[model samples]
Structure formats: C-alpha cells, structure tokens
Target: MQQCSYCVNFTPAFQIIAMTKPATLKEIARRLNVSVSTVSRALHDHPSIGLRTRTQVHQLAQELNYEPNKTAIFFKQGKTFTIGVILPNLSEEFFSMAITGIEQTALKHSYNVLMGQSHDLPELEKRITATMKDHRVDGLIISLAKDSKDFEHFNQLDKYNIPVVFFDRIPPQKTAHYVSCNLRPGISQAVQFLIKKGHKRIALINGPSSLLATKERMEGYTAALHAKKIKIDMGLVVSTDLSTGGTEDAMKQLLALKNPPTAIITFNDYVALDAIRYARRHNKKINQDLSFVSCANLPITHYLDTPPLASVEQFPREQGEKAMEIMLQLLTRGEELKQKGQFFQTELESRLELIEP
Candidate 1:
C-alpha cells in the first residue's frame, strides 16, 4: 500500500512550535477591512454579499484558519450538541463494544459524547450524574452500577429537562426510557441445553441481590427450569458482590451443597473465569465434572483454554445503538413526551450465541 504524501510529510510534534489559535470572524473581518457581519454574510455566501466581498472573506478565512464557533451556535439553539454516557466498567469487552456503537451513533447525529465510568460505586455514579447535569448535556445514557440504590441523582436530571436512557443493567421499577436485553430467551437456552445433556442439578452464580440484573438472572434461571418441569432449588443458587473473592466465595458455597451442582450458569464471563479457577483449585475439571455457561459472551472467554460450553450473547453494541436511538427520540420529542406522561421503552432479545471464532 502506498503511503499518502500528507502522512509521509507530516510534521513532528516536537518541531512544531508556536501554533496560532484558530482565527475568528472578527479577526478575519479586521484583516479583510470589512464589518464582522459582512464577513459572516460573505463566508455563508448570502445573496446580498457581492462576489468580490465573498472572495476576499474566503481568502482571509483560509489564511487565518478562521472557523465558526459551534458552541456559540449550539448555545443560541438552546443545546450543547453533547450527550453524557455513564457505564459501570469500560474495561469489560461488552461495555467496550457498547461504547463503539454509542460513539458511532452519536457521530451520525453530529453530537459529541462525554463518557464517565462509575466503577460500580453508587457514590461515584451519583457524582457523575451530577456532573452531567451541570454540563447541560442534551441527554444521558447510563447503565446503572451494580450497587446503585438511590434514584434521586437521576430524578434531579428531570428538573433540568435532561432525558435519561438506561441501557444494560437498567434501574428497577422505573419507566421513563430504557433499552436493555431480555434475559429470558438466552438464559432459557442455556438452562435447557444443560438439561438436555442430563445435567439435572444446574446451579447459578448471580450478582448481589440488590442488583435488578441479579433478579432478572434469577427469574430467567428458575423460569427456564420451570418450563422443563425441573425443580427450582434455591440452595443451588449463590449471589456474589461481583468481586473475584466474592465469586470464589459463591463457588465455595455452591460446592459445599449436599448435592453440588453438575453445571453452573455465571453472572458474566469474568465471574465464570473466577469460578473456573476456584473449581480447579478444588480439583474439579472444567466442562467435564462441571460444565458452565455465562452471559455477556465476552471474547476473552473464547481465548481461554476451556470457555463456557455456551454463552448468552447480550449484544451490548446493539443495546448501545438502541439506547442512543431512544435518546435521540426523546431529545426530538422534547417536552411533548413529558407533557403526555408517556415514555419510550424497548427491549432487544438476548440470544444464546457467539462461539467457535
């Protein structure tokens, strides 16, 4: 492949010194010996501006590197042309893919995204939400922290007319707007696959009970067992705080059961990895004495020696696109949706997929 001339001749940053600030219309007008309004009109090619005036303005703007102030323009239009997005963990592959979709969607609409990570702390989430509100962002897209408890931080955004769109790990019992995965389909597939393989004692390692996602996982796991006429065993289920130690603890509790599970369904790929390590420490072979399945279908799992027999594909990138789409709708509808006391709620199906790469 031939390198572009521009790339080959690019200046080294260390050698480039004393770069000038971007020129403004006033500077261009002064240089062109014209009024600011005349320069603006000429630059915009207004019909009233003559050819000679436009030519001079364009030439001056090019020489001075003059550019319009988009912030001022958006401010005049009662918008910042920016949106806020908060996530629990950016390092997770699922969240990384979600960010990719979010950035792509935001770019299409000519909006900039301001990202924040809560690191799974409610206090940090609260501060980030406050910061977003102060930023006067057009809208917000958030996936709540695992331990997020208070809704007041989010509630205050409503006062500023900032629309909130919750994606994966959405808040429980709130209905303004959200685009999250429906876990039933994927969890059911995992559970049934285990059952078909004669693993009757299937267990689940879930997130903290405080999390709405944990409840969703629980519902899906039991519902799947119920559909197959398998007995629901609370003893087979364990909850973790989503830490490595917590995951190992959950695995220990499950292993100590009078009749330990033959297979396990984990909260996510990370949790599964921790559990697999714990199982190995206890001399349980992966996918033989004990098999596993997980959510998120993180690519890291496929790279491991013994990945899950299968994983629930949450399609986080699609979730981000859907969430951004909903945010756009909310921003467009503005007060109309609020006035009507109506909201936009949608769900993307979670599939049992993503393996054999």
Candidate 2:
C-alpha cells in the first residue's frame, strides 16, 4: 500500500523505471499514438509538425512527467542556453544584489546561469573558465580577480565563439565588453566633498595597486588634491587589501602618522565602515576627529553608529542589466552579431550624500 512518488500504479519496478529511466521517444510515441520519428520532431516543435498535433503531443508528454535529456538537446542544438558568471565573492552585498539583477535578466531571456566564485584567485579563475567551456556555456560574464593580469584564460572562449563581458572589477586590457562605474569622477567627487568641509589634510585608503578601480581612484584622488593646490603626500596614501584584516591594519598605520589626516576616502563601504570602527577604538570621534567617505555605497552603511559623511553610489544592478542586454543582443540578432569581438562600454555612476554628525 506504499505510494511511489513518480508512478501512479506504485509498483516497485515501475516506480524505479519512472524515477530513474528517462521517458524515451518510443515510449512517448506509443502513449501519444504517434511514430517514434514523429514524437522526436514534435518534441523539438519542428516546423514540419503541425502546430495542433505538436501541442497535443507536448501536453501528453508533460502529463506523463517526461523530461528532455539535456545532453541530447545540447548535441542536437549546439547550444545549452546557459551562461556563466564569475565573481570575486558572492557573500558581498554588492555582488549579491548584482546577482539578483543578473538572474532576472537571464530568466527574461530564457537562459540559465552557472556561477563560479574565484575568491580573487587567478588559478581558480582559470579553472572556472575551463569548466564553463567544457560545459559549453553560451556566454560568460566576469568580474576578474585582483591578481588576474594575463587574460590568456579567456582566449580559449574565442575558439568556441562564446562571448565574455567584463563587469565591476574588470581588467585594464581592452579585450571584452565591459559595464562599470566611471571611478575617477566618483572618487573626485568624494574627495572634493571632503575638501569642501575644510579637510586640507586628507588621506586615501585604496585597494591593491594592480586593480583597475584602485588605479583609477588614485588618479582621481591625486587630481583632486592637485586641482586644490594641495601637495601630494605619499605618506598619507595607504594601499590595503580592502578585506577586514588588511583594512584594519592600514587604519592603524594611517592614524599613527605624525600628521594624521582629518578626513579619509576609501575604496568601498566596507573599508569605510572599518575605518570608522578603527577610529572609534582610538577615541577619535567620527565626523569631529576623522571624517570618512567611500566610493561605492551599500545598504549596511546607513545602519552604522555614525554613518559615512557621504558615499558614491555606483548602480551595480543597472551595470549587470546592461551587460546582459548587450550579450543577449549579440546572441539573438544574427546580423548584429557581426559586431562580435567588439568592446562595448557602458558606465553606471551615481553619488549620494550620507551627511553624518
């Protein structure tokens, strides 16, 4: 009297067959009163299969809980309708929000996403690229890791003709279509705001030197100071890993300086939050003793004890949306696909005033 989930009759052997054995074209043809070849063509919604008959066959197959074998579909179509996403880490709020945008876009286009986190490791990024190629993802979206300079890992995708678009943390080389914030302007805005508040002695907490964002931020920071006639002080610019430990260590060093900066600009909200906490530990009041601003703001910054004096809000979701849109256009429009191997650049940049006490 036990019930089998897959089969209505619930016979042990039939249950095994229903659960483990895929419904074949012949089995479906027998059930639908059609030949095996007719069933095969109907499942693909082939133009030769009359619409009414195809609909009837498909409905019956659905009722029987039949699932198409993905391997067979890939072999026949040469496409998996699957894309891959490579990120530094999904645990970050910014990247997680970007993922939501990517998912919505992929679903709209009837494509699947395969995600891999490189964790800022070049070797892992290479492995992920290889795996996605083996799986034959139709396209790829990536935010390269910090240490990734040589893009030979992505060169293989050219042979497969799978397009790769770079977003957020992209490389310096102009190899792929990219969607990102215009960091120089954002950083310039943040630094200018701090200077307006009478912070002539300012410092910069930056990411690694090799990173594209970090280099652009540094340029902006230097430009802002130079425009204001403030001499560039090498001692005040601290390059940190942007992770908690490295940021904390950098904060200690910056604060311990002979003439510590009264204001600091950071790479992202997390580094800014760490700076605030580190300042508090040293008995320094946030806005009074040490004002802080960051380039990319997130939701968590608003909940802090003393919110950032200001933050630049780069629209990460919009970046993700636009990146996918470009890739989809390349995939669907045959004529437009002639623009393949072209680098399309789109920038999403915004600034927000956090206005802390």
Q: How much lDDT does each candidate structure score?
A: 0.88, 0.83
Off by over 4 Å in 1: 1-19, 354-357
Q: Write model 1 residue lDDT over 116-215, tens digit each, in one string.
A: 9999999999999999988889999999998887878888888888999999887775565888888878888899889988999999998987776787
lDDT of model 2, residue 68: 76
**TM of each candidate vs. truth:** 0.91, 0.88
User: Per-residue lDDT tens digits of candidate 2, residues 98-147?
Assistant: 87888789999888899999998999999999999988899899988887
Model 1 has a clash total of 0
* Alpha-carbon deviation at 152 in model 2, angstroms: 0.4
Which candidate wins on lDDT?
1
Window of ten residues with lowest summed lDDT in model 1: 12-21
